[model samples]
Target: MAMIEISGLLLLLLTIFLAGGVWIAISLMACGWVAMQFVAGGIPAGAVLATTIWGNSASWTLAALPLFIWMGEILYRTKLSEEMFRGLAPWLNWLPGRLMHVNVLACGIFGSVSGSSAATCATVAKIALPELKKRGYDEKLALGSLAGAGTLGILIPPSITMVVYAVAANVSIIQIFLAGFLPGLLVMVLYSGYIIVWHMLNPDKSPPPEPAMPFRQKLKESAQLIPCMLLIALVFLSLLLGWATATECAAWGVLGSFGIAWWSGTLTKEAFWQSVMGTTRITCMIMLILAGASFMSTSMAYTGIPLALAAWVDSLHLSPYALIAALTVMYIVLGTALDGISMIVLTTAIVIPMIKSAGFDLVWFGIFLVLIVEMAEVSPPVGFNLFVLQTMSGKDSNTVALAALPFFFLLVAAVAIITIFPQIVMILPEMAFPPQ
Candidate 1:
């Protein structure tokens, strides 16, 4: 019995399980069971499964997942977006796209705070959509920018996706967080720059600028931005300065979110409980998937599949750039079916060996993978942000995808930039956390 034959069998079983409507986590575990039983018959399959799931599930670093999620949930229920729009509109109305820039700026800010792309898209769209429509702002630009900027939720520090990737790849979560900052900012700048350029070329696409407000008046109206800014600064600084562990920073975010909600008069007993419940559901789902992925990783190790695949890929002698290009395309295709986190967890165990063999930095690849996932968030059919914007805007998914298309390309451009100058992704992490 050859290893290839055993790998084929396990892959088939996993596919059938998935196509038959088994949950991803369950399917992964079942596949791991099948692999261990048949391919590595000498080992105790059930014992391995239990111990692997337990070990991965009990990680203290994983505690950050629920806390960050809770912070996002709490802030989601507040008037944060509404205030952001109010504060940002006056300041940005003089720009080429008028208030449409609000969508990009607000989502970037809120996404940084929330750490969930869907929440950022939904929260910003809930306020910005109707207001932009009423103000005669171009719907396409508004929708596109929102979809793109919302992805910043995962790219920014405190990102749930980054934490998952870090844990899976055995890298430093803080280093991954640091690595993402520049790429995230690059994407945001590209989105905004495209908006400005597009509006400049097609003037009528943007409404006539509102009369410029006095600088002092604009400052007064923009004061509402303070709380959101303070929260972002606190979460980022605590982690970057080594003042807190990732989990401790997440705790600080949750506490700050609660305080802000209370001051904003949006916190109720019901809202608090809702946030807690939402966090529990999301945390359980991610944890289960993590456990399954861990088991599956172990299964692949025992089967020698990952090592064999890496050796085969190495035999081809493909350059690092070529490998990254192939992966970018693969991830985009996979994005149509799997959400960002699932895509990372599903492939990392096997793909990582190949990536490391190419002499690429795992941390750099982590940032690059995240940028690809950000593109996935806005891809058609199953893009989480596309669905979110569709529900809010009452537009069909295709229409939403079309609206998001330009920003999608903008993400591709960011990927290209980072690939060409890997330092764009690595510099911040390297500078902040200099190697011993």
Candidate 2:
């Protein structure tokens, strides 16, 4: 009878659904149906469910996810990533942790190109792990950096996760992308810096051997990776300069990837078709999860779940940092169960309202949320990036898990930096796309 009673019941049902099987679509549909009865006083249930799912599923921006994903797939499987790795190998080898630098750089470059963290982890793992094993670099640094570094795929542009978050949370994709650029590079740089500094401080860790490269010869060989550079330049410039929509830029990226593969002589008919198949499969999975998320969001809205929670939290007058700490922990727990995109979808709806209650910038929260979720790629017990690495390397899972620890802290540190500074995530977005 009371609004409080109805809200409490809906929360109970939500918990039960999680226990039953986190079927977001079904959970939302079922919850929305009840909320419509109790909260909205009996709105049409079937019509609402069907209409909401259809409308949310029809978004134009959401389409950019799969296209960018596809582009990354084609480029990665084509060995363009290999070219980039091969080019950087000699240059990076001279440092301590010698070949592990390859893990970081390869992950960074592929993450830039691919836009999917798992793909970046897997793609680079296929190339770098063997070399890492052969060269006697510690497996911990090798797998850990890739597992941690792979998260950059979503932080950087062509990031479907950010794009979808922008669409769902009503933020700007370009702004999110711009917001992420410096931080993403900082993550890459910091990760690489850790390896170099660690090696420098403890010569045993990085034992410097001269990379078998004459500068001129290295320069000449590296030039062969011009296609990888061009691809990176094209995606960033298009988004950065307003030369194209993120979607259009994704399209351009797909075309550019194909061109690069063609030039690299890996663009065989079989590979192209196979890439298409892989893209379709991964994209379909993403879309299915997204469809389910949209439906659940619709249902949750009907129940007033998120709004009620926001109001309740606002009553406490918690400090911004305390609220953020709570949010970070929530994401880490949920992220261990769900993938990065789902974590953003499920949490942003609830978290953004609390964030806004605290008057933190939503754009900043979006970046912060992403940084936290991306950490799952390398985290333990369900670190998807760790598994991707282990699966690729045929190494024991424990070995890969141990390898990933350093980068995990590095990512946590990055999250702390962004959380505290705010400017780290906000400055570029503000500069690129001013407020309405």
Error of 2 at 44 (Å): 1.3
lDDT of each residue in 1-436, candidate 2, tens digit only: 6555676787689769867886664665676677777677666767876787788778887778888888998987787787788888878665667677777777777888788888888877788878777766766677677788888888876677787788778777778888888888878888888888777776675534753878899888797578788888988988888899888888888999988888778998888888899899888877766666666666667667788888888888889888888888878887766668767766666677788889898778878877887887776766788788777878887898787777778888898988878888888877777768
Which candidate has the highest TM-score of all? 1
Clashes within 3 Å, all models in order: 0, 4
Determine which window of 10 residues in candidate 1 has minimal summed lDDT: 203-212
Q: Model 2 TM-score?
A: 0.93
TM-score list, all predictions: 0.97, 0.93
Q: Cα lDDT of all candidates, in order? A: 0.88, 0.78
Model 2 backbone overlap count: 4
Candidate 1 clash pair list: none
lDDT of 2 at 84: 83
Q: Which regions of candidate 1 are displaced past 4 Å?
A: 1-5
Q: For candidate 1, give the lDDT.
A: 0.88
Q: All candidates: CA RMSD in angstroms?
A: 1.3, 2.2
Q: What lDDT does candidate 1 reach at residue 271?
A: 89
